[model samples]
Target: MKTIGYQEVREKLLAGEEIAIVDLREEHIFAQNHPLFASNISLSRLEIEIYNRIPRLDTPIVIYDDGDGRVERAYTKLREYCYSNIAVLDGGVAAWQRDGGELFIDVNSASKAFGEFVEHHKGTPSLSAEELKAKIDAQENIVILDARRFDEYQTMSIPTGMSVPGAELVLRAPSLIKDENTQIIVNCAGRTRSIIGTQSLINANLPHEIFALRNGTIGWTLAGQPLEHGQQRSFSDLDTQIDEQVKQNAAQLAKRAGVKQINFIDLQNLQAQQDKTTYIFDVRTEQEYEAGHLPASRWVAGGQLVQETDHYAAVRGARIVLVDDQLVRAYMTGSWLAQMNWNVYVLADDFAQVLVETGGWKPATPQIDVDLFISPDELQQLSTTQNIVIWDFTTAANYKKGHIPHAQWVLKADVSKLIQQPAFTSLDAIVVTCGSSLLAQYAVPEIKTQLKSGQKVYILKGGNAAWAQAGLPLSQELELLSEEIDRYKRPYEGTDISKKAMQAYLDWEFGLVNQLKNDGTHGFFVI
Candidate 1:
């Protein structure tokens, strides 16, 4: 009742049973090493994030902490919330590794590892960065499709690349292509999206010659090629209809991957299952998702959902229903997710599921008590008092960048231990602040328990962003309450990385197939 053996959890994962492996630690530390399927849902954000993550309270959930004593607190919190099927990982992560389980050294390990496995088993064709550069130099008849999210494409992309994202290729590429002679090159910031996007088109049986830009933009740079910044060449159109043949090809691929097609009644029946966690997702482009979509479905771009499954859906074995009005796009994404060991479905458009909420993706967020909120101006009024201790829950980088005057950086989970320290115990009041105060509010109730009877706790309204926006002076001095492990810096993202790190990222990806083979728990296959 208290703990589950790693082998049992492994068996559930391998068997594709309903299970969630939660790493209750700061993300940066989690990125260092953890089980391949373990998704980091830190104790600080557990209450706020769990609603959409592990939707079914009775779903089998395993928690682990690396000798940090964090798991006990997490267990108590889950129990307080009436989570029924939760258990700690017996002996924590060490026992898993000791028992021949491999701890992957990055976020989204399962997804990335599966991408490598797909490339290895399917022999997904690709062109090297140098090869792509040569083709571009000669002005060859090719269309470069940046298969990353639209914002990522705008950040930096291959020269002359247009954003097509994931399933959009099967949906819109045909309408855009004028002739059969045109070649298609798909690229992401790194390997996974590019490989997956290229393979999706290949699986759809597109007539055009297709290849993933080897190693993507990172490789493009490593090959001494220039990348274009602030590019907005996107071709996704809401008006474009998927051709009947194209739809059939995509559906065939989905069928081969064992993806189920569901109608409205079927979806309702699946959702009504009290024992199962069902995730309804609009896996279309943001534009289409905004213009119109099935109500009650969460919006995540198809490519991003596939690439960052851990971040989106923490419950690995839950049923995932992907919807797209264009139907073909859902089939394309659902096929890949099905192969990734998810019980995935492509929903039919016949439901009277109206486009009720018509705007950008709105995430379900933490409930904030307005009574505990105090404006930045009030914080300024109280700043002169040495009686107040301001603890910031923002990232260390952001804390370093700028924070409230005299605010000390504290990891949310460390608040209990921190308040015991001499400096914090004597404080008259504690003000919790973060970038948006959303994280801060989550800690307010928890922090209140640790406060002395006369002591008070409050959240800075709008947090650090509001303080800066209000033209208040910010202190750049770094006062530490705990070690900063809030975020893991990805090697492939951002423009500030060195060539060495980019190459290292590519090297890590190149070896993932071998790692996946050694791990053997991932039940992934390519159609």
Candidate 2:
């Protein structure tokens, strides 16, 4: 692929060429200023919703950030989907700006506009901090929903907003805003999630008029709204809705992510096909697996699958079949896998009979003692010791935002490449961490095998989150935030693309002429 520069992009746009300029920066940065036609799509959100938003296989696209390489990775992902007409803006937005492209600035970018759009249409319901206060004062018919994590919602919230995380909004919506006449407003700490939350309802075709609290709690804070703390909540009908929605969303997501759902007969056939390389993953919680699962399957709880899939399925071409009685769990996990372009599968209704007829294979080793899983505090202590080297296999963005004091990040899928690095060979012990501890548990054996002939190895119990929560010293590696989120800088398949990677990167930057021609997706935004 060739690269394009900012001058070329501007020239093309000035020529009145229709383009979809995508700003792949964090929400805060994009909110400051971006091209007039550009939309926000943060790296993290892109991971989850790419396929859903852009279903066309060969949509011409140009992606860029503030001079970072995220656009390159986005380009690669599009290619994986067989979309060839993709390019990156060389030198990113800096190059675009240098060429005298018009830039737009505001406290919130296009994401806020999207939120406002939601509010305008669908009669999307919303309650501002002032309105909520007025309702509280007048005892009006309005219900406030805080669609963030419980802890965060608990720490600060509108007097009436109840904690209802984004993932749970669909399930809880009906109950929270039971009376159709009652206004329901959802808010999050910031804008993206709140917009996403409100939008999810719109996407699901929910009946109630639901709107995100404009600009979320941050806006509320800036407006000098007061908050109350420490109010407890009881499980309500909304909880059931949340649980069901989680499962349903999980199943849909898994399918979208490429996890195949196999019927009983097909599963049995997998064992008979000796030539194919495959692994069975029981994605239910550990307890469900132990209560009787496919005889030799590996256990990776569904909630942790996205964070841990790369660890357990290290071989790129391997086929993975996730088994869980609950279809929802299977699908949810599968959705993320599908987006990552992994070959994944889910079991069908006759899965049990299929296992029985196959006369189950033998285990390669004893089942892992679930109890032996290390606690987060213990993991933190181990990581602090000089003897332990933590391979913090988290997304680079999350790692930069915050991480354990001495952790080193290795992308989950690219851990093998670390062995070739000079520093990796000298490490005495390694620990891995992702969103949860499951990835670290799966990484121990792999790192030990890759290290020079012999090296002691250990894993942080609950990983970095546990470390931070334990009041241990933490370091914020803000410098790392500048790295391109999408580009892994890896060589293309088969041969090293070190030079090609550089070229591709340069092309992404320098080929602005090409990017401008490619860019066009009207309704995109970063939150």
Candidate 3:
């Protein structure tokens, strides 16, 4: 495979050239340490996720693995799909460190750094957990707005917090506020969303005192404050006048942030340009996007797009177009992207007729050898007599919900480690499954490589979903063979988390700025 040095890649990013620097490791490993802008596209999901993220086959792409020998395999696989311009990082991540390149931990380093930059530059107002708790106890004339996804708010929130996700804060705030005397407090699980949400209201010139719940629910928990569970307070619809005012306010903020507005014609012309890569996103709620959305537009809610930019748009320096019918969501999201130094624009023209999709999108399945797959019926028959081992590659939450009976839960990255276990060493045949069978197919080859000679690997056709459809029994019992650390458990995800875990989470987020300072690779500029 061809190779590119760290300095060259760094220089290219600094120059704002379109390039996709992909870390070919699982999410957990990628989060441990990767270049500031590297997007984690694991080898197992590369084919399934690549087309949506990269789009242009000729776009410059760099793949790296921490000398784990996965980069070459990823390069080979990409070549089979006819990707034109691809290179492996020279000496991988270790070489980058040796050459003084910055390494960032956790996902979405750029977005997180930008959040810090916003607070630093904007000096967004905030209230400590103690202060907020005292206000709540005293019954101060205030409204607590949870500026996260509805589900996240449902998981955990302040005593009387209302759900108004980031982009919706400006649009829905006016209707929810009783009077100018009512103070507004916005919060998220941690810091980024809270800061951005508070700043957004200020930018919109809301005539009320606004403060972010400092450190969010983590702060509340650490302060020995109780968080309410399953709270469902949300904003009602706004009047036409209020909606128009929100649009005007959001537009002003976007203009101040140097966010550009593009008409449909300009967007078409922009997409026609072959020299640059462009990502078109519908930045509305998933429900709205599913009901109807522009053709070729991917669904990423405005808040999540800003919080997880790397996951949605892997190609740095690529042009991004944000679309929404209400105009406020798109402008608000575009404003943040512009401040983060992305070449971002909001669609200015109405394209309501283009709304085409009516249901959830299913990713196109990659072409895999049919022989590698076994029918659900066949697996059921084989399992009766043969000593079959089934590995479920789905998320821990999904595994807990339902999985094929007797399937062992394991991370794809940990499969090699499982080989040393006595239970797996004597397996007669191995079957792999995920929510969908696509990831299972990608994993089959790797599983085969690690197996003893003559040991066979097969994918359960259509995965667990198909097994259920075939009237097969599913076990809700958890059968984990690996530690459940592949994905970080959010302190606010479930109903019951100890105060100790919440404090630890806050400590982790609090240290990220120093980590970024030490790494020094992130090229963030706040406007």
Candidate 4:
């Protein structure tokens, strides 16, 4: 087995070498502590996600954990999947800490930290929640833009705030504003999206005075300011087209950030490169993307691609080609991504004939074994007649909302461990299921290894959805066989979180600028 020291990993990062530092812990656990550039790829999820994330199987890779033996198992699994050139970190994250390496907390730490760093270097201006509220009360001429997704804007937003999203701001702002007197304010649930968005307009030198709503909705909540729920106002795209001047400005900004402009022919050539992993993303809004898009391009809105870079591009040094019809979005997004030191490019092939494909974005869902599945009728009959256990590998939220009456929500990694317990012994059968049974199907071979002599494992055909569609009853009952570690309970999300936790989250974000300095390997450039 090969091992990499922390110093070597740091050196690779420093020299801008191609490498992927994959943390093997579960997402919530990975959020607790990890190296800046490390992407979370849980041991159980590696098989399902590896093909799409790190496309090049031979890319230099180092897997690590918090002093756990999981890395050895993961290494073996990667080899079985034909992923060569793999190594484990010496002593895991413990060794990194001993060598004075910074371990950041929370998901998307690098992006969030980079946002803070951008504000510091660019001197981006902002106004507090109270100040903005006072202006609204005084009947001032202002347009508040929620730079997050439309779904997030619908949750809770500033009064009269419109959903402009992140990359769509500059494209749609011209139509929303009547004159140069109207002030523009950008905001999100927290600070990063709003900060990045606010700066986007500023960087383009748009005539309006742009400012970020300090602290966004989180700050709005803390100040005892009321947040509007279910507001549907947004940037209207009808009768509106981006002006030529705006396009020129956006292109210049991207060029300043060292972004390259590539044509369709160039893209095809890059795809032919066997050694490089290329992530082609269409940085457009959902409605526009569903109407039409380029082939082999995934629809990740520009803002989210920047906000959650790790989730989209796990291979740190991979080439990212962004596509958009309106040059503003692709260039603006390419500008920020390039500043983040990504090998970023904007599609220059005018999009006239390239957008022949249509439909929403689809993931490369892994193929599953059809022979291992049993129909809903079979599962219902088996549940009533035999001693059987049904384990669900779906998300915690989905399980809580509604699930099969006797199904227990459990993590895939814990499924094998649970069957060894006294209560599960001598079961007649074991059934595994997820949303559509695809994920559950991925677990069959491993579950077979843990089954007792005569015990069989089956996937519930079409999973929970099929059961519901057949007029079968579903329950909201809690049947927990594993800890709920799938998704982090975001302090800034939903209405039930304690104020203390929200304040703590904000405090952590405030210090990310300093953490970026401590990490010392983020090759970020702010222009």
Candidate 5:
């Protein structure tokens, strides 16, 4: 495979050239140490995720692994998929470190770095959780807006905090506030969204004393403040005039951030550019996106799009256009993208009628002809007659929610390790499943390699979703063989997290600024 050195990759990023430096390792391992701009697309999920992320097959991609052999395997797979320009990183993570390259921990490092950059440059105002609690005790006329997702807000929030979410802060906050003199406090589980949300309102010229709850809920816990659980306060609808004003303010903010306003005609022209990669995203809430969205627009909340830009748009230096009905959400999100040094745009037209889908997304399963495949009905019958080991490849959270009655949750990266367990050794047949069966289908080939000669492996056609659709009984019992560390647990995700964990999370975020300074590769700017 063709290989590129660390210096060339660093230079390309600094020069703003389009490239996708993909780390071909599992999510948990990739989080330990990776280049500032590198996105983790694991070898197992490469085929399933790459096309949607990179878009342009010809976009230059540099794959790397930390002394592991995954990069070569990933390169071979990319070639089979017809990716035109692919290369291996010359010496992987070790070489990157030797070349004075910065290593960032955690997923979505760019967004985190940008938050620090904003705080550094703009001196984004913040109130310590202790100070905020004192204000609360004093019965201060303040509105605490939780800028996390509705679910996250429901999980845990500061007392009396309302769920305004990310981009909605700009579009909905004005309606939620009646007194111009009222103090406005924005927060998330941690720092990034809180800082961005507070700054968004400030940039929009809100007439209030705005401050981010410093370090968010973690800070609150660290300050010995009790959190309210299962809060459900959401924003109400705004008047036409208020919405129009919000749009106007958002446009101005986008302009200041150098975010381009693109018409549908311009978008069409952008889509026609074969050499360049363009990602179109509907940056509305999941409910709104499920109701309707622009054709070919991926549903990513505006807040998440900013918080996890690397996850949504893998191609660095690609053109990104964000879509929303009121224009506020798109502009608010695009502004951050622009500051993060992305070629970003906000759609400047009302094209709501162009929405094509109106339900949950159903990804088309890959057409892999596995030797053994079983229908949901057939599997149900077989379960009654013989022993069959069913493994669900869906996320741990999803598996916990509901799955086939006897299915066990398995991490794709831990499959090899799992096969060594005593329970798996004597299995007669193995059945693999996922949210839709697409991920399961992709996994069958690797799973087959681990099976004994007499043992058979089968893909559950249609997966758990199909079983549920067929009115099959589902189970909520958690039967997990692999630890669920693939996803980082947010301090605000669920209730009952100890103060120690919260403080540790705060400490980790506090150290990120130093990490960014040491890496010096991120081209983040504050406007």
Candidate 6:
């Protein structure tokens, strides 16, 4: 590894070198002024994310930090993993500016570059607030895309704006804008996502020249644009039918995976009546849990439940309850969890209250999946357009060697804390993959119950090995997963733990049922 100056990176970029510039910063910071070609991969999340996203060793990579020590740590990890070529930006973006290089004035930077881009390209799509008002007033051809969450859209927006969350844009764009000629303007609370959304469409080669509604709703508000509030609207009557259909579909999926569905009352009675320990899981993201979740329920993102069952509810005899807003996450998670030899069930009634009231429950029904498989390519493709949170439920060393790109890491010890955070709660989709799909497949059912209200859960088609062989991006580095994994590793201690003990421990953990009940923790499960 060699450290290069900012000027060299600038020259290489201008020279059109195929270099991958990585910003090792928090998402908020990266959203500010990242280079056009740079992609986001937070240093904190590196171990679990490297393999599945970036599997190749030979890719030229340069990482930059905001003068933080993270750059050095990143350099060390890359070298440890044997990444072929790696370097750090000389002084950071500041050094680039001190060298008299021009800055790309994005929203956070407060420059006129976006307006300039709109002006120079002529073909670059744009609609000013004045123009938007004129069109709204005239009822002319225009569609205002509020590219924020549905909740934000309900709070405030232009009367004509429609909510289209960023991740869903790819799937929903076609329906939002009908004609190729329809002028589209994307907006968020601010500019980052709005700009990214417009750029993504252009990258996808959409015929419409797209533009960010400069500065998003914030700019609109500053420009004296009247804001509309209290925009809540019920899902269409057809949406109700869709919800019902989705439920039925989920039930079938559960059946296919051999997951059983049970009612909340029955689950409660079992807690009161049964002497055996049961594990209850809340499969929602961390953000969702903060919003609300079942009391005493252990948090595990639905996708990661399969890989992390041992950390929380390791006993194969433990009854596992899977809960989610709809059954999609529950069923999907249950399919994989059932293979682990635990009794699993998808709560069919009072899900919202259960998640809020007791946290979650364990199901009496068992799961059996006759047909279930996913490929690495499919998981990668799904990741491209979704805010998919992947969990590589494998050894920490393997994760550090190479794992899914942008995936969050939870090693054996930290796995118990996976659902305790806010970010994990907000995820809309999840995929759990490992060195092999075996762990994820067996842990799904119990894990699915922990999902936030509306998340979709899945198993990565092929685990990390398949991902690496396919020639995708893989980080060339390894880092100690945590202090515990770091400490247990004496120079001589081995990484191998017998698979049988792992399985047996999982089964023995079922003893928690009686302990939790005697202690009045009926709804509590280890995971």
**lDDT of all the models against the reference?**
0.84, 0.54, 0.82, 0.87, 0.83, 0.55
TM-score of each prediction: 0.92, 0.43, 0.89, 0.96, 0.91, 0.36
Q: Which is the leading candidate under lDDT?
A: 4
**Residues 189-306, model 3: lDDT tens digits:** 8899999999888888888899999989878877887888887777733342356766798898898888889888898899899888889998877888889987778888898899
Over 4 Å off, model 5: 236-243, 350-353, 361-367, 370-373, 400-402, 413-428, 448-456, 468-485, 496-498
Candidate 2 accuracy as TM-score: 0.43
lDDT string, candidate 1, 238-341, tens digits: 34656889899998889889999988788889988898889999987677678877766888888888888988788878889998877887898899899998
lDDT of 5 at 161: 93
Candidate 4 vs candidate 5: the TM-score winner is 4
lDDT by residue for model 6 (1-527), tens: 47777667656644434455676765456645554335555565454444323434455677887875678777776776666678787777777557654433121221122222222333435566676677789976667776555666777777777765553343345556658787677876544456545644553345565667765565566567777776753111112222344345445645755678888887777566434445567665455555666665656665345533433442224467876664655665665456434568877786556656533332221233624455778877777777767766665656777777776544332333454467768777767667765555444543465777887667766667778888878763443333322212211012233434333332322232332223221121111
The all-Cα superposition gives candidate 1 an RMSD in Å to the true structure of 2.5
Candidate 3 C-alpha error for residue 81, in Å: 2.0
Candidate 1 vs 4: which has more TM-score: 4
| Model 6: residues with Cα > 4 Å off, grouped in runs | 27-40, 66-68, 103-119, 123-131, 134-155, 164-216, 229-527
C-alpha positional error of residue 484 in candidate 1 after TM-score superposition, expressed in Å: 2.8
The stretch of ten residues in a row with the least summed lDDT in candidate 1 is 361-370
RMSD of each: 2.5, 13.7, 3.2, 1.7, 2.8, 25.6
**Model 3: runs farther than 4 Å from truth?**
236-242, 371-378, 385-387, 413-430, 444-461, 469-471, 476-485, 490-523
Q: What's model 3's overall lDDT?
A: 0.82
Stretches of model 4 off by over 4 angstroms after superposition = 236-239, 350-352, 365-370
TM-score of 4: 0.96
* Candidates in descending TM-score order: 4, 1, 5, 3, 2, 6
Candidate 4: residue pairs that collide: none
